[model samples]
Target: MRLPGPHWPSVAGRARADAGPLLLAALVVAVVTVLAAAIPPLLSATADAAVRDAVRRDGGDLQVHSRMEDDGGPSASRIRHPRLAESVDDFRARATEELGPGLRAAVHPPVATVISPTLKITDGSVLRTFQLAYLSREGGPAVTWITGGPPEPTGSETASVPYGAPPWPVQVGLSEADAAALQLRPGAEIPLADDQGNVKKVQVSGIFRPSDSADPAWRLAPALLKPVAGADGRGSTRFAGLLSRESLPDARLAFGPDELRRTAWFTPDPARLSWDVVPPVAAKVVALKAASGSSGARDGSLKWETRLDGVLRDVSAQVEAAFAQASLLLVTLLTVAALVLLLAADLLVRRRARPLAAARQRGMSLPVIGGELLLESAVTALLAAAVGLTLAAVITPGVALSGAGAPGPGAAGAVAPGAGLIGAGASGVSWEWIAPVVIVAVLAGPAFGTLTAARATRDRRVPANRSARRWMRDTARLRRAAAELGVLLAAIGAAVALHQRGTGGGVLPASAPALCALAGALMLARALPFGTRVALKRLLRSRRPLAVFGAARAAATSTRVLPLATLVTAAALTTYTLTLAAALGSDPSNALTLAPAPTLGAAVEGGPAAGPLAAGLLRLAWVVGVTLPVLGLLGLALGAAASAPERWQTLTRLRTLGLRSRETRWVAAGELLPPAMLAAVGGPLLGVLLAHLTFGSLSLHLLTGAGPAPAPPWWGIGAVAVAFVVAVAVVVPVEAAVRRRRRLSEVLRAGDG
Candidate 1:
């Protein structure tokens, strides 16, 4: 025969082809993921460090801040009540008396927000958003050290509608996008917009490049932020493009009365308390992709922050909790993705045993195969890596980095190490640690293929007729059906139980049913013995056509078919669930529903500040409200697609059974009638019982304004029902697609011809 084409080459070639996409995928995902995750922290830490350094260099021990809480002066209400104000005054005095006189403090009126037009672009300068009165217009040593520079100077009352944010908080730098969008360049003048929709023109000043976290403990990439230091010192804060004098308004509601100014951070350091009790509050003055969704710190109390052990700790705790939550979510996503990828790879290898066996018989070495695979993968990864790295660079511009003058190179190195071995967690990305991940990513398919090939060779017993392998090919139903059903039932039950038991009610049930559906669907894939043609024929017989006809056609492949199905099913479910839940579960009063999302956190340093500030409440409520929708919709969509793979097939089979398309869909759905009925009977009852048990209330029966506060509402049932239906609907279509792909003649020919 033809000298069995050198086994090694055949195997190597096959491997390279197979690995190209996966490696590229991994690299693309890893590079972007790491970079995105790195940004916010970097900015926060850098700014924090900058401020601290500035203070230290100035020989200040601590800084203090005081502001009016009510309508805010003159016509403005007092920000602090007498009792609380007295306590605050006393605290500041006590803290300062004890801490020493090295401390200093100054206060600027609470005019933080800036409105600017879209056209302003400045380079090598500051935007001067807020200029302090004492420091600006004075040709002497800053009586008030606003550091980085005083706020923006006053003049512009209008702005062009397209300019971006000015430099804020001193550390976060600027980027090309900000520059271009605002049309700012060094010494360029542009227009700005105010909240009231007013506009004005202003001079282009210097620009601040972005800064990443300087801490070696947890460094991240930087961001583009405009710094607005009245570099020329004119004492005014610019909002939008509107600028106002920094001096207490003899005109504009007499800014923060005299007493307030005396204790303001920019003023005298009365309390002398170490900012250690609270670090700097890095308000997100501009909208950032990094802080998507949870934008705005409208509620004065909710936005405060502090420092702990040289790191961040939230006085509000709400934001901190959210970050922790985000971390958990990311971990969950990573875990699920990795699990699905591994399983899919394993399944693909198993199905491809025949091809692998043929290659091995031709003579191939595993290492050679692996090398070739690695080469293909490396090339793809390198390309994607270059793209991702470049994007990271673009998003995070180089740091201007001169703080109190650029830190010593030694200091920079000591602080940021940038080296692999330094302060990177006690355990981080070690060779041994990476070994498994690498092995899994690089060798999983090949190793598994080899084993499968060996098995196939040992059992190299092809059927006399392809149809003769029916038993092996079509027994998937027997193997997977009952187990899948049981798993799904168990998952639903478990979710209910957890709710009852006061365990995490977030998404546990959703997870369980999803896993059951995926497992069952995958297992049942083996039961499809109709052959490619038979599967296609069935599709022609399917009801409610195109939305589903392709499903069967695509499913014709006997090998690695389930993996594709799994991907589709999971993705569909996740999106559906997320969207549905977000829409339905909006309970503004619940912890899950509160906007400005109050995390039931600790009170501020001086306790609740002042009379009724509706604005503050509205802001707080808005933040809290975000989570409910996100969680609800996400859960809804995910729950629907949980059983997608099987549901899709089930629908397709019905369509093939001579039923009208709509009828076929109805019949397939009929299968879930009993489950739905049961869920209806049970879900609410359980919800009530659990609500009763946990909150000692039976408000679940009531709709809005329902019963006692905090009890799960009656509308929850409707929402859950919708989520369940969505899950079923999404999966059924996939099944319909799969069923319609088969042809009766081909199936018959394969069996008898």
Candidate 2:
């Protein structure tokens, strides 16, 4: 029953030691990749569930409102409705008292509203405000009121514009974060205009992300379409009216034909579980709508028109989508680790060429050896997969899912092989995400390993001219050449695909294609051997020996740098493109600095002064320092990390050349001079860009003329310091590699062979 010639266990034991570093590196890269992709979605999921649970448990089902008045009261006409309100306090009290346990409602008055203003671009083009509904939050986050995970508010100013349109920044969403990021809370400067008030300037007090039904947001005068700063960077804000509380009514229905029966305007937090709405004249039909696709009224503006027991499908979809994305990323990561193991198996075959040749001489059949190879590959792949999955589970944190990360459950990107999901669509694991991805990854790993082993074994042959082949025509050269070509194509394709997706959206052409890039890199790196480093040595002569060697080795050798560099490149591109787009795409409020020529919602007492007066009340002391840098420290971190390696390598060579470690560090630090300068220019300039864009592209000086200057990213400069320490670490090995040469004994041995 002799089945296999070579023992599978022997192959595993021999290769395991060599695979350790690659495995560790793979683990790190995979973990980081999964985290960056998954955290945002995970955080969003947590918040969404929390909000839904809190709202439903609170017993607030429906809210009926018509409009707001100057004294923070509902418009007179709305008060006439059976369950309508004149004052929010009156409504909150009465609803909790009368409705008892069945319904719960609380209304907070805003100082002013920023009505959908006509949008005029800087290019002198006009954009219509046909669809208008702007959300502007003030003060602190509403999460403080509700005890939950990351509070996912329904809709604070989801955008600067009234309806969905081009955000002033080229491509980014509004900086709809919590209070610590935005810097204000409730009761400060809420808002300026209202359903009845006439005002321009508004204040911010609190933050909330209400659903799309907040028609009252448009009660304030249209804010100017100007450039604004945001949490990420500089972008333009459309109708960026500050979310101030009720100051005075902006307008009222004077004399419409429906006098006692006109349509009513109301604003409710969609994030709330249910709303208690009493239709005009207490009509039975009430509808609801949301931009995120919440449903109630099958009709327009009525996203949901169901009875008291709302379906909540729309809200749930958003949360589940994010959770699914995180989970998928986790699965893909584990799958990638398995692929790495398979790649390792291929390398193991190549490294064991001498041992295999001896086996062949000992009368081992090809099929028997091949079978052993396959079994070993499978075991290794599984082991790596298990370890990777465990790493992923351990590193996951309590993240607040951002809608940005939620591309709806599965990222619709690469699929994992052999993955499985439990349920789907609000109930179970998403089949589409888990099944295909895991299955493909699992099957592909072993198949790939076996195929590569078969091919290498079949192609195994001693060259007719062993001497010429060793230097020029052997399997090593041919294999190295093939690996280089394949990896080049795959990595380039990955880079290209990454560029396309990042510039646009989604992962790659498919999940498999993205993984191909990884496979290609591994294949190329392993196949190329260390010979390529010798070939590329000339390219490093201009730098210090250590740097030159590092560059030569990192560049020419496939295994040394390809995988990590490729990953670093992908991560850099992702972080950079998204950050830059977000920085350039995000916008701040123009109302933060400019006031609207507030006009009454209805016929009012004070005319022009009324608008200014209400606006004036909003400019409070606490409101003085609410700055949001569209491009903040996140940008700095990315920039520094991108350039750290090269700087460190240069310093290493100097240290190896007998310079003081400290001196070498400084020299290495000096290498960062260009990027450091870049960080300097980019940091303050980003601040300037943010302030100007957010406040209508105004000329700026921090703390003196315009406002406070952005604080320099001392941390980025500190990165240079860290780079110096790294240089010392790199110097030792780099010098050894550079000084590497075949000794006379080795050359004589080679000649004899």
Candidate 3:
């Protein structure tokens, strides 16, 4: 060119020529990136929904209850005079503050109350005891008066009165049911005497009913609304009457500092909760409980009780188990994706071998050539990853929509609004998984390119003696054996760790299946050559020329470890996915499988937490079912195509000896079929073995609600094997047909060149 300009036109032409491999590289990167980006949001949504459902089911049990009993001790008497109401308020505030911000924001305002010990009721002749309750108006339950208004305190602050003396009585409200059972009405006065013979009279100020009995305010003491039969077996009934907040100070005084029980209840608003806040909230609750019991508490006698921590702990455990299962499946998918990428890269290297060799012969530096390849690959991979991430974010809603009507309440665990590139939920997308996938995709191209270029450009001289060649072969064999042994040991260790630690083992357990597959693949690759050689020897003895040639060709082809590994792993994953789906679907109690009653269906049908898990598993199964076979076939095609040049030269020579094109295809089929058949047969068995090994440690019952993991589904495994074999059978002819189109003259000219 004029002025010796850069060969942009030639580079463009080369790029156009290699569009197939480049596009494939990009597509693989994009797909893996999309998968990586999509998984975290789905898991987050599922976990959040599960936590919400658990919180909802817990109902009032999740309310935090803090109470203190003061026996008129010197310490209690000191705090009683200045107004016990302030002390009660202080306790409520302290409990709220200790819950941490996340939970504090979720809690309903505390309902403070004062409770009196059992005292003899003098109004009724039954000699019963009445429990006095002073419910605060600020955060108390809404009540509708059936007869009279709420209670109000009298002006007197006397702690007690003489047993027979007339005294100012505390005014109290009672529920209609309680009023009827106690034979008392508004304005009726009941005299109660303590164990020490000190007396106090309480008049029924009102008869009322709670507006919502299920409200958290009423849950603090059910006895306040209804009479509780004493556990003494004497059939003694104790009735509780509610006094207004204004009477709380008087009630405290009348009961004496020693006999009063002051309490506060804080209920959480489920709407404000999500899975992400569970651990911290639970920890805070535990801390609050411990602080209440400790001497450092606001009141030395204060005691805190709440099952919220336990409820949240159960939710956390379930979420972790669900995540472990999901991670296991995702890791398998990623491993297979990695293998496919490597196979594609290997194909690309083979395609560029001739041009790369020519450049090296023309005095082009290896680094320069490698850098150019690296640049091209890096650009393609990056662009593909960007497109993939975009597509994942876009299609996430659609994927979620497809499972909208799934059985569980959490089944529609769609990504929350505002989820993007910032965080896990509304704020942004979580990049914990997405970043690694993108990095791998972007680097895969350059790494494979640079390495292949270096290998191709390295100078090599043929071994001069048979002993030298044997030594080299032995060295390579030993290296492969050591690598295989290492993978096997790693797999064993991962399995042990998974078994011991279960879901707590983190991502380490996820690698066991992949490592096991790698070890198996290495062994299969080692065995393939020996098997092919035996076939070749047997064919040579038979006088069938086409069979002999095909066998010889098959025996001569180098062992294809990458393609074999890809196919085996894909098959194993497919088998495992199908088996798991079958087991999950087989559950008789699974809402997904059950049909509603024909004519008398009940009004409410609740699904288990496992519902979302099963839905997710089925979705994953569908993906693995569709994806693995295609990738396996692609690997087979690439492996076959890598040998295209040599195959074409061989076919040309055979054709010169009058071998028919049909017979030449048989030779190609011979080379492809053995490995395909081996993978088809062995992969499912390996998958079943993997399932057996891992399911015991997986605790799948936590998600499936089934008894022990069922045996691997034989029918499904057989079907997967059949489908894989059929796919390879179909691919064989098509590949042979493509090779048949390569004219002998062109192949001959290319060989000469």
Candidate 4:
């Protein structure tokens, strides 16, 4: 019977020797899992916040109106019918209840009129305004006074006014400019006549000014009720005024039929309102309408208009869509990371093949050997899991970053349901989901290690057959080429499908660049060996000894060019994304880095320079670009280490042949340089081509409005150079380190010529 493998003492020695690579593999798994856990939630939160803010900046969440259509008929001309008033009341109550306390709700009579007041300006020109009246409800705009404070309360307010002294006023507020033009001031009395020629004197209780907030709603509020000379024509200072709900009856007495005919009331325009004040009020408006039931819906002429809800929902959907794209990118990145880790593990396993083979020959069963390796893997996995989970927990809460600059008015005011969106409040990581994440991280390292170790052992057991090996070697190239071609074709097909989907709305597919990058890299890697060999052969014919030797060596090592190619391809993908973003002049990195984490923030900053979806895609692309190359570099390092044993032996032989150490290092450096250089040039070119192919039709106007194609991203070239330099730096040291540890005699005695 075969004996079981020795216990910890025997296994510990081998584990120690291989600890560096094993730990590196674990680290990769840990880091990848941490990033994976953190990214989606963070990106989702950020995108949501950004979209909400953008929508808020435009207006509140929605603009709701219960309106009776005026077909310019005599019936439409009636201003104060009981059915209309009751409908408005019902709509307001229902909207408040249904929309909940989080939303702002207001009731307006759908009344806007061009009122030619009985009062005359100092210049003897009659002043007119486009007048709109809002009922004083639980949530409605206050007629704020910029000067002389608010007017005294009038006993005329009805029960509908819920706050602040019943919201009754016998006076009006005018914009500073309008008041000045009309020679009016605080407490000034102005006479106004109704369509029936009834006249009443209304007091100008205050002179108001606009706030610093650029919210067009509040900024134009003072003037919306008033008239502007520029737009309303230059006969007089067309007055803009603010009036309380209690003043409505008196207003009718002072205004004419022409004014009444021009009036209709509705919720404030979303695009015209401030973000901070719109959402809650809008929700309240919706609730009010729903509560009104058939009262507001009685006639075909009566309609409830709500455009902001759909707009807000669409904006939120954009965020969710961007999250999907970011998730796709994360998946791609993780896949690349997994592939790199597996490659490195395979190399480590292969390096230990001779020891494993000897053990097997000494009566150690495969299962016994496999158990020890499995134990080592388990240990590594546990460590990785702990690190990954810890990191995930710490980082997740901090990732609720805003994709847009800040939460706009929609996120501002009260803690409404709308405030639960991304960037509006702090987001916590769900521990329920974290257990699975930890498990995945734990499994990542061992799964790949065990598979590689099992494969290596099996290969060891197979007896050498030169002809068979020759056939396998020859066919490997063909298989690689076929795989590359297949990938390219599949990427092309996806690109076509993506193109047909149109970029009119929602998030664009992230897979386009990832697939293109993979296909391009693989195709280039597959072709590199043959092309290098052919070119080197041509150089070999020159017959200069050093040149011949270098070219011959390069041609021989061309078989192992995939890792270098992969490194380049990954770098290229990153470059392409950043270049595209830079070309558009919208730096996603700035927004991401500068944005605040989700919190019950004060007031948020301004809108993002880029659209939420656009910024999100760009940010995801940038992150993927930065991270993928790291995986590529790790793969290259493993590839270098895997080839170290053979390289050291070759260098030892050269040293014995009277070549100095410096010359040997140069030869080694040169061996690595060609592939590195080839990848550098090919990688960026492929990336640029793929970018153009996938996003060529995307708005060039994003970069420069209706202008010619903008300049190429020169920064991408710099990135390539940096990546190349880093690759060279990493590769050369690996060679030198391996060289330092080896001696001529050790190599000579180890069965080398």
Candidate 5:
């Protein structure tokens, strides 16, 4: 017979053997990767939606108005007078070019006005001072002619027509409402005198009504459509008369260059506005404003005025704050996910211990074993990451440039036909998120495997040198205590820093909740055995042997820091989510919670209003709602599974002592329930406390429309705590059932072998 060489299992066979643990690892990795890939884009879209909605709702305030007065100063002479040398179209083209694409520029080229203290209309109404300004026919508001038609330019260049005397009066139009209020109708002539006492007569060529009063064009000059009350205490009002474009020259001649003003209003295309572009656009607007104010500016005579930059800055701030809050929550989830991945890796290593020990017995080096595990894990994690990233890309909706059909409140409108979408071309996989998760998943395998193998091979026999052993034991205990104390102190420091600096302080403040949770978990872990020992003593006094046996097992149970921390952190995150939802839900303007706010307040005095920012917070809450529960459940299940082998051994012994399967499960439950219950109860309390400590510092008033932060949602917290308990209770039985299905003989043989 041919000498049989050492046999190794085929890759397919090994994969089949380790399928359960590997599959679990793959699933966890995939889920985490999906979260990493999906969240950034979703959050980005949310921010984009918030920003765009605010911009659109800005309405008239969004206009960039540049006014150039014919001051006839030295700076005015230095500026190129494009209007003087070019046609109206050429001047418009030049202005449009200067403004750039996506901005519609309307040139209200130098218009002369006749400002009079009083005007006498046909009905003998002596109206207060009315200014008759020539309105540019180009880009004018759409209107329905109630009586007559729009004014036509007469082409007359008369400097001053004697009131009601020369070549017909300058043709003008008035809103029907204005005409009705002033007792003026079509064919009515109003005589007005300029500041220089030059007389001009304007005849109402038409009485019209705006087709849509909300039209942005009407916002450019509202006084033309409605009268404005004068500042005088006598209740005098100021009115505007809309003269035909052709009358501009005549008015200019009569009023002189001193009274003429050239204004150009630029309205940005809402479709072009997004969160990413806000800074650059805002910078440009600021620069424009600065240039307009400078004597050396290209168009020094023009003064550009806009609240757009201030509005954009406010929007940027709100978005950053919202992002900071969201980032904290997301970081919490990632921390929990990392802990769960570690738990899963530990489970995988435990499941592979027998095979790995056999390999070591066959003379495999620790490095070789670790390398194999690392390769296997890296391959599995990479594959999972690819699938997860693809799935995330497929599921996430593309970011639309068009504001139409946005999910935000008051955002729905007709979609522009050619609007661009940000899709696969802009893959939202934030590498910052992906790198950490992928590194953890890949490294967890080999790290846990190597350390576990090293521990397994360590000599466990007691040393004959009692004094040295005692010293070593004390040294180890002291080191652990020092480590725990250091962590605790660090946690406290972080919390204080977070309270002082708030979320804007970056990573440290964001990590505070996790640090606090870890500190609490560590303390609880240390206290658990002592607490269990007390329970054990109480149980030993009881008549029931199952209770006494369960208590003993629980007292001897090893503390797992990661699982406890994961559970506590998940609970806290869930509580925060519920609390935030409750606060936003309580707002009377439900629009802020349900979607983008129906209106965005001007960033005039106080700041941008809280509605859009609140809506962004609600979106983050929804994200937390989906993610935290899954992470918590996964952690709970993994924790339960971690103890299954030991629980099974106890169950076997209990059964040998004539206990029923149901009784064995009860014993197992008793062993697990105390810690689970502790986490369930303590986690929410910690969350509530954290909220109290951080909410005020979080600038939450921005989300609550400057209101005080709402009280914690006690009912919801209780419900979450109860649900956690129920989930843990359910998990214990499920784990027991699964363990029971494994034949007792095999379990015993495996344990012995």
Candidate 6:
């Protein structure tokens, strides 16, 4: 339906005439859309960091260890599970296959034994002996072999004492004190004994030192035993004493899998893992436990009890909750954004009404006009969406989700550091992101256009039956009142429910309050036409020409102003309610109490580190709270801008007719500023009131404790209001100056009415 070739200028000219609203609409849509794309990944990244930290601290995501009986300790025969090696190997292989490269597994020696054997080391001559504890790599990560190497010739496969010789000489690692007493250097052959009267001749393969914090059992005595001095003045190695090493049968005496009889730990790579995979990981843990049956069970003699880190379950729940909330709030914000854009579109279409009528008079069909409008909206939506997505990509990573170092996830005052998982998580955009943005942008434009066209067509299709119109009007009024009453009752119910639910650090179900706020904003729209009528009545009584003209214009435009005002009100209330909830939820005292006891069926007790779940919620609240209002303000600004042209033309006429510049500015401000201010100021107040009504003293208490509610950022809100007023006041004179370059006839021709 678009005009072709030479006639295309008219289409382009009409677009330019409505450029202010189009651009403003695009800006509003872009901001909201970008936020929707960016928030989920950011929240997920934040929650992942919390989970990662928990896993790191707890050792791994899951632990499988032997569950020993409490009676003294298990007997030697019972403790030595011959099936342990096979079962562990099977479990590891299966888990690795299931979890893929993302799995990170580590084996830990039993907590009851951090040291291996206290071995008797002796000199060859007369068996001069020193007893000292030995530590292997599995025992002490801090143990550093100082010289020669790993004990040469790790023990052979045979379970008998005085076993077969290793590839190299039998070897043992000794601490400095042990080596000094034995007078043995690295590579020196030393004799060692076990309690079974079995003797093994071994080399002192390495002398090592253990960290101060290593088990005392792993360290040599403070002083070394000295042998009688020889002619060279060095202590003699010759001695006469029996030696032995004390240890249980089947104890893991080597680092290899065959001797690894205790417990094994497995964890997935936190960077690769997400909350969704927790259940499968848990299932693997359960399977491993089941495979390693109880101590005497015939299925498998090895007894393995598993403890998946408690944090996994909690963080998983929290992340899931956060994403759920994010999805809900995202939908709400988008709905508001669509409404704002629709209003702007409607205003733009109204400006084109005269031109459309002129085109129709010249024989242009409705289909052609519809086609051109669709093309315009599609191009605009696509351009705006691209800008929005690009902007989201650049700015999203700066949002901090890693609430680190705060006393758990719910720590009150800690803002998450701006780095950490952002680099690793959701740092980039993919097609999963691009597709939604394009679709929403495309859908938003057509949505607003169709609604606006419906209104315009309805107006043109009005029938000429006065009685029928009266009856229809009355029915519409009754329906509106019933709707308003229903909304009011719903708002009260929601407020009460919110109060009850949100009290004492509980999760606030936001849907009800959000609905209440939306309804309240629409209800507030009723005041606009009444206020405009009264103001017009008073203005008509004034002697001033600007007042009379401005008042008349305001009365004429009240229909357009009311719907925009309602949208502004809803956006403001939603923003304020969300912000208030965020503030309350983020307070340290208000953190949800994580389970203080261990989950059923798990051996370990107590909860994971506090704050991850709470912290994530805080971040969600802050993001939504801050973004919602900005969306509303953008809509408000665009709404104001769309109406500016008609108001400016009136001001220019007043200026030309003999009114002073200041009076013209005043008249322009008088017409435009009230509805914007009322929506902006009233929306937040209405929101807070509704929130308080729903959530009660708990809402207020969460914000401030025993004192007055911490003041809302009124100064910021006021600044926005003042800036809006000043801009409206300034634009009238600025446009008059720009239009001074045009002839008076041109100004007259620009009038929409």
C-alpha TM-scores of all predictions: 0.35, 0.36, 0.82, 0.69, 0.79, 0.64
lDDT of each residue in 1-753, candidate 3, tens digit only: 533232455356656888887787677667766766665556556566666666666734433344454424332342223255666777667666666787687677777766788788776557477778765535557888989888876764434333323544578888877798888889988778877777877888899998888876666667667777762137677778887666666665565444676666777777777656665577777777776664345444556777877777666656666666666666777777777777777777777767767766676666666566666667777788778767766756533312211121122122111111212232134345445555665556556665665666678876999999999999998997788788789878878877776744556776676677667776777788899899988888897987887777777774767888888888887777676666656676765523332211111124555555455555655565666666777777667776666765786788888988777777767767777788888888888887787777776676667545747777767776776667656765776666666677877777821
Residues forming the 10-long window of minimal summed lDDT in candidate 3: 415-424
**Judged by TM-score relative to the true structure, which candidate is superior, 3 or 5?**
3
Model 1 lDDT per residue over 332-440, tens place? 2332343343543464464355676665566665545445444544444445444543554444344111111121111222122111111111111112212223344
**Which segments of candidate 1 are over 4 A away from where they belong?**
1-12, 15-316, 328-355, 362-390, 397-440, 459-565, 580-753
Q: How many backbone clashes does candidate 3 have?
A: 4
lDDT of 4: 0.53
Best by TM-score: 3
Q: Who is ahead in TM-score, 1 or 4?
A: 4
Per-residue lDDT over 1-753 for candidate 2, one digit per residue giving the tens place of the 0 to 100 score: 844455757567655744643353334333333333333322433333333443334323343322222222233222112111124334334333432231233223232222333222222223311111222333322222221122112222221122222211110111234233323354333222323433322233334442332334333322212223331224433333222222111111111112111122222233532111211101222212222123332222212122232323322232232232233233334343333333333344444555666665566666655655555544544454445344433433332222122223232112211111211122212223333333433344335444544554475665688686676655666775686677567546644543343211233322322344344334433534444455356645554553554444334323443223233222222222222222221223323322432310111122221111112212210011110111112222223333333334444444455765555444433332322232333323332332222221111110012232333233432443344334334543443343335333443444311
Candidate 1 matches the true fold with a TM-score of 0.35
Who wins the lDDT comparison?
3
**Candidate number that wins on TM-score, 2 or 6:** 6
201: Cα error in model 5, Å: 3.1
Q: What ordering of candidates by lDDT runs from best to worst?
A: 3, 5, 4, 6, 1, 2
| Model 5 alpha-carbon miss at residue 4, Å | 20
4 or 6, greater by TM-score: 4
Instruction: Tell me which of candidates 1 and 3 scores higher on lDDT.
Output: 3
Q: What is residue 377's positional error in candidate 2, in angstroms?
A: 4.9
lDDT of 5: 0.62
For candidate 2, what is the lDDT? Answer: 0.32
Ranking by TM-score: 3, 5, 4, 6, 2, 1
In candidate 2, residue 15 scores what lDDT?
Answer: 54
lDDT of each: 0.33, 0.32, 0.66, 0.53, 0.62, 0.50
